[model samples]
Target: MKRLKAAVIGCGAIAHNCHLPGFQKNKWCDLIAVADPSTENLKKAHEKFKIEKAYTDPLEMLETERPDAVTVCSPNKYHAEQAIAALNLGCHVLCEKPLCVSMKEANAIKKAADKAGTIFMVAFSNRLYKGNIVAKKALDAGKIGEPFMIRIRFAHEGPSPGWAMSDWFYNPEKAHGGALFDMGIHAIDLAAYYFGKITHINAMVGTLAKKIAMEDNAILQFRFASGKLGYAEVGWTSKQGFAGVEINGSDGALVVDYSDSVQLVTGSTNPSGKRVIRKKVIEKNPTAGGWPIEIDHFVDAIRKNKQPEMGLQAGIDSLRVALGAYDSDKKGKTIVVG
Candidate 1:
């Protein structure tokens, strides 16, 4: 097998903790180059990963290395620009999610990916979770007959003082939006993945806890094209982190507590008119949260000469839903998504 030369476009936390290590672990990929404006981060990554080349400018690295694949781990504002550049350079791109800040940018990236004819995957890592996979499979297998509603909540203490590479996560201009774009994108994307395309979005976004210019918490309600109703709560200010999802169906319900396991419950009315709930742990072992699986998926798609499962359209769709939520909040009305 020919090892694909992979480059990372940012030296941030996502790049360091996820993309870089992911590339290193994949036998079919070679981590050849990395780029970031922060010399401190560049040096740290270079030393830690023992990468061959590092550049202050991503374009420069792309031009010089001409890698077979690239991961766009930059701030939200630079995702589209960097991903488009890599695609135009004939490199398969795995971009971190939220895709881009706006639909226009997302469309631009789509055009570039289409022209390049390379594997362009968005890194929506939540989809790779075992619990999510189990839920999707159960739902598809009709174990949960006619899933009617979905609820997802993802929250963590703000990104201000930790985790993120820098303060960019707190800056509206750089991060795009706040919790909605950061944590909510995952929930939005996952909702669409399970329920189908979101047709309508109504949301309330606010900066209730954090002092950031952008929203720190958001509550989003969505109606899917499949007639499924979904709701998501995302926050960067919570005493304890939380990640959980529930899908209610006619026959039963699938509940996923991402911190632990996935459960399926079926209820029926007994002869005495009392309801009986039968619960089972359909899936366990929820420790599989990382970038390696997603990265490997992208590489496998490239090698097979097939479009990635989470391709450009998925990214565009998720971004559209997110932007719709923002618009709905700003206009104080439900926004329709085509």
Candidate 2:
């Protein structure tokens, strides 16, 4: 396929740092169009990326330009609607995480994708990370045995009015849930990716600090179909940045730590009870890179007429886990995840 035309649906922080620049780096992708309700953001993206078209309304861009593919970078609330619209227009879609605010919307998008015969992918960039990939390889090799248990944690300083000085990140109506929905989905999806299907979950959400309407902190405990137990703790009020996932098995364990390491430790009965023979670690970069590989993969999948590594179902499963967490959080009991 010759250079494919692409459009961006939202001009938010993730779009700026991840999707927009990532696509710009792809030689086979033409960053032709962009859409955002904010005129200022649309203008900046247009000037910076040299995109041919900019619109405050995505429908206008879709109806007028009809690009081959579109990246839905909008908030969780709009992901389903915009993606459904794009798929209905016969365009493949790469939608941002938390596929939709509800399972109904996710299913609708899935149906639309199927009916339109367009590739619909959910962008969970963590799966593209070298560290995560390495972890998967080790697990596949049985380095971590059968994945009997796991613990995942991710936290940040939380989003202000505009963490990047852009806009519209904290509003519940725009963002949907809160920290759990915003950040927890990564861990949720990754666990499913590494171990197995998530069968059930129980969680608690609370607004520990910050005068926000949504929960700034959340704790979730769940079980996967493999009979493996797992827990995830996500928060936006953390003063110290911490992010990592650890998977435990009968014979050994896999740990992905923020200190830049993916270590496989084995032999619980051995002296010292463990050892790290292979260490794969990533240093923190100020710019925080990852999207380049994601965009490259997207382009490759499109050209090859294949599904991206993270497909629509993968995205929907992740969102279901996140929603399950929310349900568990509210109901104060474990909820079964589809």
- The C-alpha TM-scores of every prediction are 0.96, 0.92
The TM-score of candidate 1 is 0.96
The lDDT of model 2 is 0.81
Please name the candidate that would achieve the greatest TM-score relative to the true structure. Answer: 1
Query: Residues 230-270, candidate 2, lDDT per residue (tens digit)?
Result: 88899888877548888888767777775456777764354
Q: Which 10-residue span in candidate 1 carries the lowest summed lDDT?
A: 285-294
Model 2, runs deviating above 4 Å: 161-166, 267-289
- Candidate 1: which stretches are off by over 4 Å? 268-275, 287-289
Q: Compose the digit string of candidate 1's lDDT tens values, residues 232-278.
A: 99999987755889999989999898787898999898799999889
lDDT of each: 0.89, 0.81
Model 2 lDDT at residue 31: 85
Which candidate comes out best when scored by lDDT? 1
Candidate 2 is scored at a TM of 0.92
